[model samples]
Target: MSETLTLPSHLRAVRAAIADALGIDETEAVPEATLLGDLGAESIDLLDILFRIERATQVKITVADMADLLQGGIPDEEFGDENEVVNDTGLTHLEKVLPQFDRSQLTEPLTADGVLGLFTVRNLTDLLTERAAAAGADAA
Candidate 1:
């Protein structure tokens, strides 16, 4: 994670917030880095990061919002099978939205929790920027 100033302002703010939440160097919050897999961000850290993001961008995105966006309107029962494993339909949706995730790495069925590995910093930045723009539009 080399120090660089080439990132966009929103992305810079995201990286900074993530790094600050996780107690890591800002450079460690690379765009492609997975929040859970690469940076070891836990659920609590996510809350802290979101708080920081809201403070920085004035756009709030709750964890439930993230879950809904990830699900893409799929029902909770359909999103996960009876065994709580992600079904083929769920996998398809995940692959479509979370292209950063390597599905081949799964040696067994992917649980809902495993999907967190797909959430990269870039995804957060993109989602946040979209939400911010929508907020601005509403304000207008």
Candidate 2:
């Protein structure tokens, strides 16, 4: 990463895994970079990256977990309008939960499918680290 990230070890592991999965140097995986878009990660890369994260951090995050984090448990109908455009409720929740979401950059009519584009390196790291913390707390 060009900007040095003072992240916890587990969070650093997320970036490392992403870089490895994409066959790029570790420094390329900036936190703000969107894995699917900026890093050119496909669906298969995500699975490999997640598995690597699990091995390194002991936090097993499935694809469904990432989807759930993005959707915030909002039902499909509630997340989007009848036209399948992201509704106000979805927008509000997304902004509140994801620090990376910049409302200004978004054009209108953001479809429900487009939300996945918001998934960044920081987002994935936060998800795995949060789950790892929760698992530790549960064990304690």
Candidate 3:
């Protein structure tokens, strides 16, 4: 018997948007996986993906939102030192925000740069879903 697909509607739409941004097949965009590592998305591709996601979901995702998520709700300046090295407290916050990644794989001296690697397809979907829900609530 052929099994019906059970992915959430928002997740499927987000996956398709990511696939289109990355120029990859939709089948390769797994929700639980990292976009940069698993899907071979470059840093430059992220802007395009974000634009596509916003258009597809009709949600306005701001740079501040991305920064807050990346910094675990902490201000960017507070998350690190002048050299951009993440302190212990920042590491703890990062662990909380990006639980999808293996913390053990992080470099000995973690920097803000490493956080970029933690963003996953699931994260994007979650952001879009949350924003869309909030927008719906505001409209209603």
Candidate 4:
């Protein structure tokens, strides 16, 4: 089997953390799901989720960003409701913007150690955001 490096990049690691925390399958972990009410995730679980997401995507998602995402942030009218776009922060849907990802590559596991290695709960989002901005610049 191909290693994780060959798979398409995704937020799978992030979802996996949420799933693990909620004791559910990855499929049930949707973007719109509330971490507390829907996934039964406690505040600490949310921090873990952010950490995993950063590890999985190599993107830093800030506390403000987390708040926005958790709250169903303001959407950009350009992408329509089908795509979750953050208008306030100028963030577009990754899937919409970067369509080249191979879904298979998204299967890699985001282990606890790996997630922790990437970020701490408090800094995960902000670090992820900074990384993403830098990456977007390189891609452009």
Best by TM-score: 1
Q: Report every candidate's CA lDDT.
A: 0.86, 0.86, 0.77, 0.48
**TM-scores of all models?**
0.91, 0.91, 0.84, 0.42
Candidate 1 lDDT over 37-123, as tens digits, reads 899999999999999999998999887777876788999799989888998788889888876765677799998887766788998
Error of 1 at 131 (Å): 0.3
Per-residue error at 22 for model 3, in Å?
A: 1.1
RMSD of 4: 12.6
Model 3 agreement with the true structure over 1-140: per-residue lDDT tens digits: 32116778778777877889888888788767787778888877888887877787778876457667878667667888888888777878877877675557765777788677677888887888888999999999
Compose the digit string of candidate 4's lDDT tens values, residues 14-71.
Answer: 5566677667886676654545655676667766766767667767655556444323
After superposition, the stretches of candidate 3 with alpha carbons farther than 4 Å from their true spots are: 1-5
Sort every candidate by TM-score, greatest first: 1, 2, 3, 4
